[model samples]
Target chain A: MPLPTLAESAIIVGAEADDWRAAVRLAGRALFESGATLPGYSDEMIRMIDEHGPYVVIAPGLALAHARPGPDVLADGLAVVTLATPVVFGHPHNDPVSVVLGLAIKSAETHLETVAELANVFNDSSAISRLTTAASVAEIQEILGNAS
Target chain B: MKIVAICGSGIGSSGILKVNAERVLKRLELEADVTAAHLSSLSSDAADAQVILTSAEFVDAIGPTNADVIVIENYFDTEELARKLEAALG
Candidate 1:
């Protein structure tokens, strides 16, 4: 199945998250509320960051918060939260992320497929800035073209 | 040569890095096998790889590796990938 779009993926715009963990939690909240994942998924996402450093901060202003495939992930889905105030993940360069994208995949195979498809959305250098300022889920969908 | 893209979890944007690396390699007129892998399994997944592409934050975690570890700041930036790949493997 294709990844959920902004409508079903629980895209939260201009959300309030004071810290990186809170930011990931906001995204995870979206995923949970969307019926895409279990409640403990957010804590897992945070733990990944804690154990592996802030490597999830994939881009200058983006954080692809995720954990390995597990029972916590109800389905292959995604969630996004735009922080009202950007949070830092302690990465030297990609710190102060504005967008926290929660990704839950059932398997590594589909995981690859999802990211390959998402490559188009992220390829646009301005995607981060646009997503950061998008007013609503519709605007987010617009910014993230080829939304499924 | 084989290249492995490392991320916190293999089942995430490492796929993006893997695909984008293929695109960059093709544009540079180079060739290699690329795979997405989790950082924790660096020993097995990257055992026979010649190059390892990953984010800066994961570099130190990689510890010691025979392969050339390249830091990619932006997995979506093909231009940066092209430049870095050219500089390293040109």
Candidate 2:
């Protein structure tokens, strides 16, 4: 199935989050509102972060926050949040994340194929660069349209 | 084989590591089950992982684990680092 766009995922921005943690919280909220998260979703996601760091920095500006497909999801869906300014997750290769993609899957198996496909799309620099500069939901959606 | 790719956040750089490892593993004809995890969460899952892969900065976190730890740059380019991982696994 086709997933949501960056704008659809980016429900919170600089105005909402003072830092990356707050931004992740905001993204978590968006995911919850979209019916993607169950109870203890944030805790599991936070656990992943606490254990790992911000591991999903795809490019200079993009970060995809994901966890194991166990506790964080109420349903199977994906959420995205874009930052007005980059936020750091402390990953050495790229920090200051501008885009965050929240993924929640009902089962670990269901997520593998989609995540592998998403990884391929995210690997494209041109698509990532356009997403980084997009200023509005529509623009971001348009970028995803091209990328997807 | 089940391969666990680890990184600091398990978000940014590890994603690349996962992709690159998948590519190399594919080429090597290794039927692999690869997943990416943050270094913090690595402990619980490390017992069954055939190989533990990550980047240079976070290498210390692997600490005495049974899995062999291989560190590379965060980006997807694999020529140099892939060789290192291949050697270690052998």
TM-score of chain B of each: 0.93, 0.83
lDDT of 2 by residue, A25-132 (tens): 766777887778864666676676776555555446666666666655667666667777677878777777777767766764445455555656664557666666
- DockQ list for all candidates: 0.79, 0.27
Residue-wise lDDT of candidate 2 within B1-90, one digit each (tens)? Answer: 677877654543455567667887777666777787766678786778878776555676688877777766434445544686678765
Error of 2 at A118 (Å): 1.3
Local lDDT at A69 for model 2? 60
Per-residue lDDT tens digits for candidate 1, residues B1-90, read: 899999888877688899899988987889889999987788899999989999887888898889889998877899988898888786
lDDT (10s digit) by residue, model 1, range A58-98: 88899899999999998888888898889989987787899
Cand. 2: chain B TM-score: 0.83
Which docking class does model 2 fall in?
acceptable
User: Stretches of candidate 2 above 4 Å error?
Assistant: A1-16, A56-59, A145-148, B7-20, B27-50, B55-58, B65-68, B72-90
* Candidate 1, residue A78: lDDT: 81
List the candidates' TM-scores in order. 0.95, 0.71
Q: Find the candidate with the highest lDDT and give its number.
A: 1
Off by over 4 Å in 1: A146-148
